[model samples]
Target: MAWVTWRQHRPQLVAAAGLLFALAAAALGTRIPIEAAFHRESLAACLPPAARTGCDIIVPHFEAEFGGLVTSVRVLTVLPVLAGLFVGAPLLARELELGTYRFAWTQGVTRRRWLLSKTALLAAATVIAGAAASAIVMWWRAPYDILEGRISPSSFDIEGLVVPAYALFALVLGVLAGLVFRRTVAAMTATLLAFGATRFLVTEFVRPHFLAPLHRVVLATDSGRGPGDWVLSDTLVDGGGRQITAAREDLAVTHAQLAGIDPHTYIVTLGWKRLIAYQPAGRFWDFQLLEAGLFVGLAALIVLVTVWLVRRTAT
Candidate 1:
């Protein structure tokens, strides 16, 4: 069964491997200069405000040099969709489209076993590919992540266990789409749409509410949120819990200017505070596990549905 699975999916396996290798090579090539700049400029020391006298110049210069590469890397968030479209969508759709399912089903192997074997083999390949690609990206972006925060959508999505989990989910979703559509092109199209929609919904709606965010009240002059913190909301509020209007704020600022006092200091003196709801940087792994488990569970459920559908068709 393993040999048969390998023979059937060798092209996909080879293509995935090649893609990983290419990405790894790109990451390795770029990482050298990025790390050198980081150390040469002593960017780590500049993280604190006291040490950041001229980091404004140094940081922007470093960013200008590698900003394009970081942008390109962020675009790799769609890699799972590509994997689904090319590998998973065609897995069963091609067989069914060519009417080879009938021939394959008639062999001594049971339909359930056959489906499981193929799914397991391909799913493992997808996971490994995802992990390899993620490792390369993470390594390449280590300096950027250290300077900035990984809590940002672009960095978070491409690192840790979530990457592999997302790939597994995409692969399973494509396989399920193939089972339903029975046409390679249609299945691939459906997989792309479904995977994209799921990702959008989760990233926008579900992820923010995974854990109740921490709320902190600080003086208006101070933004207590750090670089890696995922700030949900930052609102200017009075002691009475009412949001301060911009017009009122402007009036206050003008009054403070006339009084020869800083507007920010005057606002705080008037009991205006910044109420921030955020996920702290320390919870990175917790969120990663939460998100990865959600996707992996969904993939398992989709695999069960695909298996059931395949069995019913065989009967």
Candidate 2:
């Protein structure tokens, strides 16, 4: 049965393997020192000759951020999508379409057993593929991450969280789509649409809440009277990268003596900002766990649905 399953799904497996191999090769090739030096080479066109300091951090006059964005898109966005589509879309739909389920059923394999074996096999393969791709991306992007200051935990919280989980979700979603649609083409299309929609919703609407809800802080300094008043604003961890909003602490005013008269200036409060930053007391871990559980639960739910559908399905 296992051999039969492998033979049946060999096309998808081969395609997935080939795609991953190409991605791996491209990633490795791009990691060469020369490749990094040449990334976005067109940016040099905008720089003045004198301004071209050979210092590492020199801005290329064009968008330096574009390279990192492209890398992120390739690693975290494109590959996982292809994995989901190729791995999940045809798990069972092909069987139904080809009328091969009759043969398997007549051969004394229970529908549940058949479904379980295939799901287990495919799910394992999907996870392995995702893991390998992620590891490769992480390794290849390490230098770029350091150069771009993306190693900061805060940045990781946003980009890293969304991509992998979305990949897994997309895989499970493909399975469910295959079971529900029972046609190869329809399953692939539906899986892609549903996957894209859900990913859009989660990343935009739900992700910001994981870290203290996003808010803006208005900051300004005032010089006046006896001393410059440093208002008491929100206290954040120094160098811990937490952003907060609060009133400034009282500050004393100080000035240098002019030729004749001492210059005195005072600052009056104009207004507060349109938004404020505040950390949820301790919801950080809870949010992470919640998101993780949500993805796993969603995957489980889809698997269960697939199982039910398979039992009832003739194939």
Candidate 3:
């Protein structure tokens, strides 16, 4: 079964390897200039808590120069879904679609064993590939991570246990889709759509609440945001402690200009405050584990369902 799995999926395995190598090389190649500029600007002196020391010009300039390249790298999040589309979706679907399952399933091997053998081999491969790609990306992104924050969507999706976990889940989802649809292309399509929707749901609605976000009030001028903090909302409230009305907002700006003061300072003088909701940087790892565990658990359930279906499949 092991040998057969390797022989049948050799092309996919080779493609995955080549893709990973290309990604690693590209990352390393790009890192040279990014790191060089980071040091050239002496931006280390601009690190948080003292970010105001001398960062007024260099930091923004640095980010503006390299921000597009860094942002483009976020598309690597698609790496995990490729496993589902190519490897897992076609695993059983191709055999079943071409009526080769009769020969494959009846070759003295039980369907469950055959399924487990193929699934296990490919599952492990996807997990390793996803993790390797993630580690490489993380290494490349560290300089920017130091400047920005990893909890942001662009960074969070690609830099932790969750990447491998997403790969595993995507693989199983593709396998399940293939088993149900019995057509490689349809299964692949379904896997892509489902995986994308699930990712969107989790990222937008579920992740922020993984642990209750901390809510606090601070002067608008202060911002009170530490480096790496994931601030959800920063709203300006009036002296009456309500969200500032539009007319009042205009008045505040006008008052600030008349008084020759910054709007934030004027707002503070009026006893207005900012209500902030944020997830601290310290919760990064905790959020990673929570999200990873969620996906891994879902994958385990999928494997169980796939096994049950395969066990009752007619040879």
Candidate 4:
């Protein structure tokens, strides 16, 4: 059974290997050095003693070089969906459509065993391929992830890898579609639609709202402050004891008004930056394990459907 399975799906295995190789090559080519961007030793020397300041100098920008590679790994988003359509969509559909299952069924192999063996073999292959793709993406994104605050506990806990469990789910979905529809083309189309809808809903709607809470903050500044309010780059700060809008051109009138309001009296102002904090409401492993389990459970449900349909119709 193992040899037969390998022989039948060798092309997919080769394709998986090729995709992993391409990802690995891209990762190595696009990596940026985080150490140089963040820990500059000469920044103090360039600044005047009076201008010395304390600030959160996260890493220098590395997103430009790594953005393309990050997007490339997102290809995995559609890979499992396509794989299932190509492999699982036709597994039972084509055989039944062409009346070839009759020959195999009469050859002493039970329909249940045949379906189980094929799904088992294909699932294992799909899982391995997906895992390899996820690992490559994880490794390549590690450096920038650290500097960009992306490797935080929350991101790591949520749906991070685009492989293994996700791919398995897609493959099973394809198999179920093929068995239920009993037509390869129809099954493929249905599988693609199902996969696209599931992915879009989960990513765009569900993930962000899962246990996330919202809050609002109010900032009240002194009347003598240069500006009533200001919004700057998240990285910019008044670390040098200067106002937030000290260099901005739009605040000229505001600055002049403030100067007249308090040349003799100094006014201290407060600026508020509203940010959502999604600290894990509980243990980290719980969410990670939950996400993995949910997807895998969906995959198992699809497999059951595939088994049931194959048994009923593939005879």
Candidate 5:
């Protein structure tokens, strides 16, 4: 079974490996200079309040040099979908499209076993590729992550266990689509659409509620939320718990300035409080596990459904 799986999927396995290698090469090439600059500029020290002023100039310079690379990393977020289209969608769709499954199924192997073996082999490969890509990306972005935090959407999607889990979900989703569509092109298209929609839904709606976010009230003069904190909302409220409207804020600021008082100080004097709802940086690992587990569980459920479908439709 393993040998046959390998023979059938060698092209995909090789292509996936090649892509992972290219990504790693790119990450390593860019990482060298970034690491050098980090040490030379003493970026670690700059993160502290005592040295922040001095390092402010250096930080911007570093950003200026590597900002493009940081932005480019956002593209990695799509890799899981690509993996699904290329590896997972084609897994069964190609077999069924070309009528090869009929011949293969005539052999002594049970359809359930055949489906499980193929899915397992391909999914394992997808996971391994995801882990490698995640590791490389995480290392490449360490300096920036330290400064801005990994809790942000851009950073969170590419690091830790979640990346592999996402890949697995995509792969399984593709397989299910392939089984349902029975045409490679249609399966691929469906895989991309389903995977993208699911990702958007999870990131926008589900992620924030992973844990009940912490809330705190602060003086309006306080510098907003902490660096890297995933701030859900920042609203101004009075002691009476009435929300302060933006128009009222502008009027207050204008009045305070006319009276030669600091606008923030006047606002505070009026007993307006800044209410911050946020997920702190400390919950990075916890969130990673929660999200990874969610996707992995979904993948398992999809795999079960695909297996049932394959068996039911088998000759």
Candidate 6:
């Protein structure tokens, strides 16, 4: 079963390996200079809960130089979908579509066992490949991540257990779609649509609420940043928690200047404060584990459904 599976899927396996190699090469080549420059600049001094005055002058320049890489990394968000379309969607669909599953199933193995073996093999391969890709990306992005914080979608999605889990989810989604659609192209399309929608909804809506976000209030003129927090929103509010506008803030500052009082002091007297909502940096790993578990659980459920459907078809 394993040999037959490998023979049938060699193209996809080879392609996945090639893609991982290319990503590693690109990441390593780019990361060497980035790491060197980061050390050379001694920008660790600018990390939060510490002096950041130098960051005002230095960080922008670093971003300007390497910002393209940052944008490029965002493109990897689509990688799992590609895996589903090419690898998983066609895994069973092609055989069933070609009417070759009949012959394939008669080769001395029960259909259910055959299906489970092939799916499990492919899933294990995908997890390994996805982990390799995640490791490469995270290692390459370490310098940028340290400066920018990893809680953002781009950083969080591509690192730790989450990336492999995402790949697993997409793969199972593709397999399920393939079984239901029974045509490779149709399955691919369904996989793309379903995976895209699930990912979009989770990323944009569900992930943020995994834990209640934290809040901090600062004086209107004072700097407010804790180390590596995923800042959700900042609002200017009075003691009553009514949102205030920038225009109102500027006017208040002007009035304070004319009255010979410090702007911050004046704002405090008026009960104006900046309210920041954030997910603390300490929660990075916790969120990673939670999101990964969510996807993995979904994948397991899909696997169970696919198995049930396959067994029914054979019966």
Off-target runs (Cα >4 Å) in candidate 5 are: 48-53, 250-269
Tens digits of per-residue lDDT for model 6 on 2-74?
9978998899999999999999999988898898888888888887665757777787788788898788888
Q: lDDT: which is higher, 2 or 5?
A: 5
Candidate 3 worst ten-residue window by lDDT = 48-57
Ordered from best to worst TM-score, the candidate numbers read 5, 3, 1, 6, 4, 2
The candidate, 3 or 5, that scores higher on lDDT is: 3
- For model 6 the TM-score comes to 0.88
Minimum summed lDDT over a 10-residue window in model 5 is located at 47-56
What tens digits encode model 3's per-residue C-alpha lDDT throughout 129-231? 9889989988998888887879867889999889999999999999999998999999999999999999999999999999998988888788577677888
RMSD to the native, candidate 1? 3.0
Q: For residue 2, give model 4's deviation from the true position in Å.
A: 1.4
Candidate 1 TM-score versus the reference: 0.89
For candidate 3, the TM-score is: 0.90
The segments of candidate 2 whose C-alpha lies over 4 angstroms from its true place after superposition are 34-76, 147-165, 214-292
Give the per-residue lDDT digits (tens) of candidate 1, residues 115-187: 8988898888888889988888889998988767787677889998889999999998998999899999999
Q: For model 4, how does the per-residue alpha-carbon lDDT over 1-315 read when each residue is reduced to its tens digit?
A: 678667767877788788778867876765545334433533323222324444223112344544565555555556667677877787777877788778766667688887888889898888877777667666665554443333233234222444577788888888788777889899999989998888677645554444443322223232221111111112212324333454442354366466775421222232322222242323233444555567788889887777776666724
Pick out the ten consecutive residues of candidate 1 with the lowest summed lDDT. 47-56
The lowest-lDDT stretch of 10 consecutive residues in candidate 4 is 224-233
In TM-score terms, candidate 4 sits at 0.68
Model 4's number of clashes is 0
**Which parts of model 6 are misplaced by more than 4 Å?**
48-53, 220-227, 244-270
Best by lDDT: 3
